[model samples]
Target: MKKAFLALMAIACCHFLHAQPTRPNQPATDPANTQAPYLKFPTIPPFHLLKLDSATYLTKDDIKKNRKTIIMYFSPDCEHCKHEIESFLSNFNKFKDIEIVMATYQPFSEMKEFNEHYRIFEHPNIKIGRDEKFFLPPYYNIHNLPYLALYDKKGNLITTFEGTQKVDTLMNAFKEKKK
Candidate 1:
């Protein structure tokens, strides 16, 4: 009986010694943990998406070298998404130099209509594409509709925005100094 009691006490002590305080998982992009290979994972992973033209595709390779890039992820039926695009177009002249890649995981037909409605094709600086493989949201751990991943001229990620980002903030991010 004493041996059994000692064994149970040992097990309880082991459990207590091994106990860990639980916490939410930090994003892979968070810099504190260098073990995560995501922060400098060379431009938000290699993505292959279909362009608005439907016949052609837009891959990570197509992104212009030595140019700033904005990867805008949106949905067709989302009101916030519409506002986000409008906000961008309204401030286009200021953002003309920055390359924009608008992407959607929805149907091709819907993206086509949205593109037409916005006359996005007229803006050579912007390219709209379809994320058919549905890779981005999970990669971004996205919880918002209009997510924007902003990269600098050197192809390094400056930061990311989840929802409706102010035009001024966007501009400031464009001008963000290297860290």
Candidate 2:
């Protein structure tokens, strides 16, 4: 009986000693704690991207202005991206007042070919470029192609959409932001 009692006491003491209190200054030791420390919003982050010309670098300051901006992340070989660009071209009149900046992490030659295929440069409001360093994918946590982030005239993020969104849906997001 004494041996059994001593064994139980040892087990209880071992458990108590192994369980440590979490310190206020230290991070959680739990391996299952995977939640982000903070929430991510649609605000534009500072980034340096190369234009299709491969000579000019467009920065965050260069794109900011007193106008709404639509920044799209796409891939040259993505069919969904092609569809989105086609939608924009077909509905160019509706987006005339908005600034459209399309960026891709693909090579300059591929971006040039894609731009030529769509003639995206003809539109004064549109700008297509390459993100050589691939900064946007991780920053935005992109998981799919044709990601769109719409910012208001004051450079505040209005909303973000992933995948192929209808033109009306895109426009309505901006309209709602205005309110």
Candidate 3:
């Protein structure tokens, strides 16, 4: 009986010793404890989208014509979306060789207002257009806001990033293709 009692005590002590006290230094139990989740744009589908400002529509053929491209979906009323654009605008020169097309599901009036409000005309590489009825989202299987899709010079999908990503990460991703 004494031996069994001592074994129980030892087990209890071990359990107690392993129990961690809640503190700042202690690892968090949240999902954020792991690295942030990243989204890669898919490569299976093709894109055929229309422009909001003009009658011209963008097809896979159109994208195939470019050496490289960046297709992004944004909203005129979205604060996060605007923030993403502002980030791109801040480093517009870095992507001088990359064709960028900004698509919005919102109305043309809103896109126009947003362009005017943000003074997007200053950015030579960004093309603002409407995506309300465009086929880009479905073509690329993108169901999230502020989607940034990168393609190679050969018109192949390189990567598609969802959500707000660090500009440096994106720049590095673009530069990696050169190597």
Candidate 4:
């Protein structure tokens, strides 16, 4: 009887050793998992980018010397980008006092159709520029389309909107100047 009990216990131990665990890396004391906080957009450094029409480029100085600037980082092929720009254009009067700089990571030729189709050039307050090789977007740590950044007349960033902002909200943000 003793021999039989020992033999059964040894077999069970062997079977348990060979079996795969359901949760291999987790400890019993802390079974639940936790995640890290989402990374918000970081403060961006001022830089110059090539414009489409003019031989001269745009830089942080342009924003400082002019009225407040609303930096619209968008993609030419993005429908959200189209909608956002269209909405802004439709209510251009609200932001007329503000300078609108439309920038993209795409090449100039690629953006030609969207630029022409939307007649973005028709708006006097608007300035179209190209990032060429995704330089500005990464510099701003922009991860999504239609990222809107509002900067004061001194080229210091006031606030950044991750996605599209309603006209009212956007206008409100523009009204806020650095103190």
TM-score of each: 0.81, 0.79, 0.65, 0.68
Clashing pairs in 4: none
Query: What digit string (tens of lDDT, one per residue) describes model 2 on residues 139-172?
Result: 7667788998888888778877789989999999
Residue-wise C-alpha lDDT for candidate 4, range 58-143, written one tens digit per residue: 66556536577788898888888988988988898887878887888687786777889989878777877776656666556677
Q: Comparing 1 and 3 by TM-score, which wins? A: 1
Q: State each candidate's clash count.
A: 0, 0, 2, 0
Q: Report lDDT per candidate.
A: 0.83, 0.84, 0.71, 0.72
Indicate the worst ten consecutive residues by lDDT in candidate 1.
29-38
Worst lDDT 10-window in candidate 4: 31-40
**Clashes (candidate 2):** 0
**What residue runs in model 4 are displaced by over 4 Å at the alpha carbon?**
1-45, 54-56, 64-66
TM-score of 2: 0.79
Number of the top-ranking candidate, with TM-score as the measure: 1
Candidate 1 segments exceeding 4 Å error: 13-44
Candidate 1 structure lDDT: 0.83
lDDT of 3 by residue, 1-179 (tens): 99999999999999997785557676666643533222233442344445545677654554435567888888888777888888877887777777777887777788888888878777666667776565666555566778888877776667788787778978787779778
RMSD of each: 4.4, 4.3, 9.8, 8.7
Candidate 4's TM-score reads: 0.68
lDDT of 1 by residue, 96-123 (tens): 8888889899999999999999999999
Model 1 scores a TM of 0.81
